[model samples]
Target: MNMFLINFSMLWSFSFFFIFIYIITIFSIIIYIIPSLKNTINYTKFKKNSNFDYLTGFDLYFLLLTPLILFLILNFSWSSYTISAWFGNIIFSSFQYKIFFFIFFFYSLILTAYCSSFYFHSKEIYDYTITIFNFFFWILFLFSSNTLFTVTFFIEILSTLIFLMLATSTFSTTYFYNNLNLNLHNYFNPTTPFFFIQMLMYFFWISLISSLNLFFFLILFYLKFLTFDWFIFEFIFYFLTSTFTLKDIFFSLFIWFNLLFSIFLKCGLVPFYFWKPIFFKGIPLHALFFYICFFYFFIFLFFIYFLLIYMNEIFFFFLIINLSLLIIGIFILLFIICEAFYLKAFLAISSIINTLFVFLALNSTNFTDFIFF
Candidate 1:
């Protein structure tokens, strides 16, 4: 119990530090924007034709600084743990250095890709701001998730940010096309506004349903066990399962089914996958890259962690789901190969197959087998 408290306190402090940095970044941007705003007003009054750059060097500097700050924090945390470790005891038992390393690697990759893409492409200040905030929320999600509640909360926040990113990208592109009198039909189908709204509605409904399912499971679990911490929940669940009656077993299975279903929806697996291609089609390339590479990868890692905790008890059920996914994935793969023409749709469908393969790998008994797939 004391150790749990210590871990919780450390986690809380780290989360607070990240939030403080985010606040400071936002305030600094606002300060920069004020001067830019005055310049825009002056240009308007003089009828000058100069373009005022909203995304200045200052904005890019702060954007680049975020990942560096995150790297330093993780390094400091890991080194503190390493320096304090002894024969059979550790100061920060809950800190997973491996996960931190993985996060840092992927985050740096994402930052590099984002910077490169924006450097060559036209930029919008709103898109840049949204992307920065998205990264901040993602860092918070990765580091601060300790309970089921926090996981769900962060998922919802990230979903909202993704939606905003997609909407803004679509809006800006449509406006640019309009200003240039370009034929939108050559690039996109069914007009921008209609397709954008349709995509947003589909994404919104899917996210809402997934969140509700997970929240229902969380509420039920909390009512039964009176706690939200992942380790505590696992311990209590194991203890209760040993003595569970047949009815209790079924009830538990139902609860887990909801939880698993929610995960599947979030991961864009099989039946819940229709929205993904549409969602991908409407967003800008960079936004789509982040959604597929960072967002879905995080969701997959989260799903793997949850399954690892409950694998023994849920083995039979998971096996059944795995086989179903395999059969369905193959058929979907064939159909997509035949029907998918657009690049974004092709990428989206391919990601689903890749995710299905990874989930199939989870059924393997050996670690190397899992890695191989």
Candidate 2:
């Protein structure tokens, strides 16, 4: 109880401090904008250019989130972690925070680039709605927690919505299509950038559904196991103990299989992979920069984080499945490279397949998850 209170007080104080700093920064920007953006603000762009002031102001607010994020990271101590905080089981360590930090770092770079480039291209992006969306995406993604519920409730929803708004802003809703039967075209043309990013996010929603379905399968079995008292074997202890029998071993294997496949789907691995080629079209130079540097980097960090958790559940099933995935990933990678007309398509395909290799290496090693930190 005392620890909880201390943590809560710290959290509250930190958040308050962040908010205070952020407010001051906003006022500072207001002063700067009043003088510098005088022309861009009251005239020329929107008939109602005042609309952008608030939006741009909010857009600038994301800058302050960086210091708070870094402070949380700097204060992170792997050995001192508690499973529950004010946010309810949202705090912990192991590969989780390291992976979170890597993800935060990776996404931060892309976001910085995106915001900078977008500001330069702001005159081109005239939609007030898009400005609002751009703000939410940066803020929501920056603050989204690593916990499962937070990821589902915040990141998955906001990320999808963010891209959807971007997608629609760039083209008529009529231009978007499911078009699964359609082979990807325009591999060498840089004309349509959002079209490609939008399609990647479109398939992200589908992959989300598939991952959830498989995740619930594991949950269902988990609930069933609780009736027979399996939590003592699996949850409380980090590893299987001598209290188990052959039957328990097989059940553990089953649970492990569920975990492996669920993560596989989530990371865009084979058997559930479809979005890559569709979005591997020739995008604008800037869009391609963000896509290649940011998108794949985000997914790869996620894959590493997830793989560390379940890689200990070594069974013949895991071995066989991973080997199969590795073979398939390699074949698809080569075929895509040979067939692709553009470098972007090849890069995307190669990055997707490389995630499987990451999984394979982690699974085959006894290096331990903590070593990755």
Candidate 3:
């Protein structure tokens, strides 16, 4: 018990320190990039009413996120090697710990770049690239982590907050540009070069907080100060994410149970449809459907949120049944929707396939139920 506690304590401390370094790195990039930006600022172009070159802000943030991301990846790589070398052939306890740092660092970078670039290049080409990258990076991140439930719960919260911010900000920006007649290109774009940087800061800060909270949660559980809520949360997520038939009996039962559990805890689930309509209205049509479907798809996430508050054995089985249904329904849904819409067809198809595969595996007896709770 002492040895386990000691290792747990060290992991918590190391995770905190790693996050600290990560924050410093982002701030350093902002500080470094600002000067070059000031030097490049051309008042004459603004004064003459020329369209602000989209590439400038894009290039600056790209350069900023790129090098630091590379550096972080390098650090994770080196740290992993150091652990292996020190431990020789033994399965060191720190093996998974070291991998989490790498996974976190890489996923953060991919998300930052995806966010930064998506703003400037509204072209279908770049948008899809970034989405694909983010999706794959998220997969790798979840796959590599040592503690699935802790990481996933953190990710779900982070994603929810980010989507809400996006929905709000996009609404505000669109309103300002269309109604107020503010030039989104000249007046707003150049002045707000730090937009992506601010988001990066916010995301990093939240991740740090979540990491700390995870440590405390684990420690308390270890000391028998709290019960492990992992099974409940994880089970719900696995069911909701993996299930296929959306409007079916099994699906409705899951949602009903989730709502019941949420009410019990006094934490209500957001009416997901309300959030997505505004979010989709702000983006291009192709992107609109994409965002809407993605948001709609996660309505199942309510199960996870509710599970965090209350755990019942029946909740776990309900999750599995719904997930099995969801898997089959999503693939057929995709085939129909993609054929009808014909927009961002590749991503549309990919989303369905990916969703189906995740669900199919979830229902299969061989699948791991580790990511929930």
Where model 3 places Cα greater than 4 Å from the true spot, the runs are 1-58, 69-73, 76-149, 168-282, 285-354, 361-373
Tens-place lDDT digits, model 2, residues 99-125: 456655655665565555443223223
Cα deviation in Å at residue 358, candidate 2? 2.3
Better model by lDDT, 2 or 3? 2
* The candidate that achieves the highest lDDT relative to the unseen native structure: 1
TM-score ranking, high to low: 1, 2, 3
For model 3, residues 1-373, the per-residue Cα lDDT tens digits are: 2456546545655664456447545654564444336448742322233232233335444554565467456545644433321112112234344544655565455445445544432223332433333433333333333333444443454355444444333332332343232213222243232333344455444445545554544454343313333444445455556778575445445444443433222211111111121122233333334343433233333334333334434444655446554554555464455232323333434444554564445344533453352
lDDT tens readout by residue for model 1, 128-192:
44464455545434444656776777677777777777666664543434323222334444456
Supply candidate 2's per-residue lDDT for 361.
64
How accurate locally is residue 356 in candidate 1, as Cα lDDT from 0 to 100?
69
Sort the candidates on lDDT, descending order: 1, 2, 3
Worst 10 residues of 2 by lDDT: 172-181
